[model samples]
Target: MITYSNLGKKGNLGNQLFQIASTIGIAEKNQQEYCFPFWEYSEYFEFQFKECSSVENWTSLREKAFNYYDWEVSHGNFDLNGWLQSERYFSQSINKNLFQFKSDFEIGLLDKYHYLFARKTILVTVRRGDFVNNPNYFQLSYKFYLTALLHQFNNLQEYNIIFTSDSISYCKKHFSFLPNVFFLENLKPIEQLCLGSKFDHYIVSNSTFSWWMAWLGEKKETKIIRPMKIFDGEYSKKNDESDYFPKRWIEHNENEFKLENRYWKLKVYGYFYALQSKIQYDLKRQKKIIKNKIKDIIGYK
Candidate 1:
């Protein structure tokens, strides 16, 4: 059997999806019985698998798992607590509908947001609630958003440009000057994601919240653009070296990585082989997954 849980900060639904996606991958790859935790937003899903029992007594994997999914680990009872953020863990096949909200909730959103889907919509996801000035995180300059938007639209009048943000005031403050842009209000967090999954194109921010929206919203000729730096500090995932963001997605403001970002400590200290191994050995096997999460969200990007 395999089970997943969030051992990180509470109320982070995007990180929670990564935890869910990875566990589902490991379970399906090995054909093991799956156990996903029932946390916030559990009530929204139409669960297909049996309800997961508490994994408190289960063995935390002892075998080595090099991949993000831990699928390589010998088949045995294990509880998966890794961040497992890489798409390599679960590609298009492993339950694409895993995150769907209840039909009633979706119908309500559709009835209200029908106008958004009517036109060729460009969904701009702005995320700056907790990340505004938190030294570890970042706020994307207005320049990045405008650059991404202008890259797609020659005359902004022809297309529907919409802004959806956790902080509506921030979006208003930065993008309000633009013509014909509208803000979605009074949306619960999950509702926002459900709504975003239907938009035509996206200018995604560093937030994994928006990442999921753009990912779920993909279609033929759909444009998905993101910042070169994901999370500013330790959580950053560089676009060039990683498949953490899909190959099809375009990334803007690459200089942020080459210039302002100083998050990669391995490079900061000079990559001494001895130092790297010491840090690896110092990490406790089970809990080390959490630290690996902080570095690259627990695997090769």
Candidate 2:
């Protein structure tokens, strides 16, 4: 039997789904009976695997397994931890079966937004909550989004840009001026995931939540734009260590391109760049202050 403990690990909805998907992938590959022990947050998602089962004694089994084998070597041997994120190990067929929305509310929301799916839609996932406040995480500038949008769609007026985010207010405050921009608010995490998967194209933020959403719906025709850096200045140098970004997706780097012999256009581009930098700096500071206040209020050390 193949089983893993899902206790005491504080993870977002995306990571939890990935864990379950990884287990399903491993079980199919190894032809083992897979079981995922329930955690507090398991009820938030609906997962089903024909050969998989759940048990209450997940913690006890996990402890016994750890005591019997070297934790690092044994865990890595099965390729359990990295399978979901790695392109080499990921099985789309298995994952598609594992993650499904069980709630009627979530399924209804997907149907409500079916009109967007029928049209030429570009899903833009902007992660704000903890990513903006945390220095360790990579937060892409609005300029990156602009660059990617301009690169992908020469005529932005033709397609609908659907913005889904943790902070809808933040998206509206910054991106409301853009043409064809629309926001979907007050959605459950699973609902957001389902909605995002239906889009024709994706402009994803440097967060695992956005990554999973893009991965779920990826197709031969699908175009995905991802940030080149996944962390701040010094930390971003280590991006080569992980196989997070798929080969087919476009990676948008932060470097400025020089416009040759177009003096007027160069000046205009420089002005926009300067303005974007200032706005990004201010937003980062504000988010950090807000995060600190919340942490203090919650007495989180």
Candidate 3:
């Protein structure tokens, strides 16, 4: 068994998710049973995650949780440690049903906002707050966001835009060119993430929070715009000795980010996707209620 008892210690939801997901991925790849500590986010999502218990006859791996090396596989109990961030560790055949909102999750109530996304929509994830003062200069440079928008979209006016951020006021003040965009209030973390996944395109910031917004999306025609490096200012493409961004995503370095090593595409047939589609359809009738309240929850600048 593989265990993640002290996974984050005190990491944010996104950070912990990345590490745990990688553990799941690794366990699946090796066909070994893996166990993690109790997940607090369980209130929002549902999955058959084994709660880690006593560990014995265990060995520890210090790969920094970046890459999946052939030598890292183990048969007995083991421990996974570090800020493991990379799709590489997820293995190509990772489980999709591993994550889904609880049956009572608020996936349906937000579809009224779907009409705002009825047209082409670009969801920009502007994650700041603590990272702004992080000594590593970990935040995405302002230049990265603007440049990604320029290269990916031909006309900003043609698409509906919305953004969710810890610093929404900062985005409103700085992204004046995007005056017509919607400013979504940060909902409960899981609900906000569920909402973030509904967009047609993305401009991801330099955080695991930003990475998962794009990763969890169900849209195939979705266009993603991401910084080449996970963090701004780091020159080594191999950060923490690993590449964080998926090889398939659109990359824009802009010499942005100082650190690296961070880290889902959901298959359409997965239980989550099928359930998600059903929920959206079922929620269609709640349009009047959602429509009346959407404006109150969303801000316009």
lDDT of 2 by residue, 1-301 (tens): 5554552253776766656665555555665556655555455456643322544443222222111122222222232333244444445575565555566755687779766665578888888766763566776655567667777666888888898888787677656767888898887776787777768889999877898888877878888988875676655564342566776888876456432353455446546764775688788788989999999999998
Q: Against the unseen true structure, what C-alpha lDDT does each candidate score?
A: 0.69, 0.64, 0.68
- Give the RMSD in angstroms, all C-alphas superposed, for model 2: 7.0
Clashes of each: 0, 0, 10
Q: Give the residue spans of candidate 1 off by over 4 A.
A: 7-11, 47-49, 61-71, 233-241, 254-301
Error of 2 at 275 (Å): 11
Evaluate residue 207 in candidate 1 and report its C-alpha lDDT on the 0 to 100 scale: 79
TM-score: the better of candidates 1 and 2: 1
Error of 1 at 149 (Å): 0.5
Between prediction 1 and prediction 2, which has the larger lDDT? 1
Candidate 3 achieves a global lDDT of 0.68
Displacement of residue 161 (Cα, Å) in model 2 is 0.2
Query: Candidate 1: how large is its RMSD?
Result: 11.5
- lDDT by residue (tens digit), candidate 3, 1-301: 8776766584787788777888877877788888887777766667777787676657877664354454366577888776677766674554445666666565574654656665788888887665653434454645567556766788888887887899787667556556358887747777778777767889887778888889887467888887655543543434553467776778777555322222012122223543554466557637857876886778522
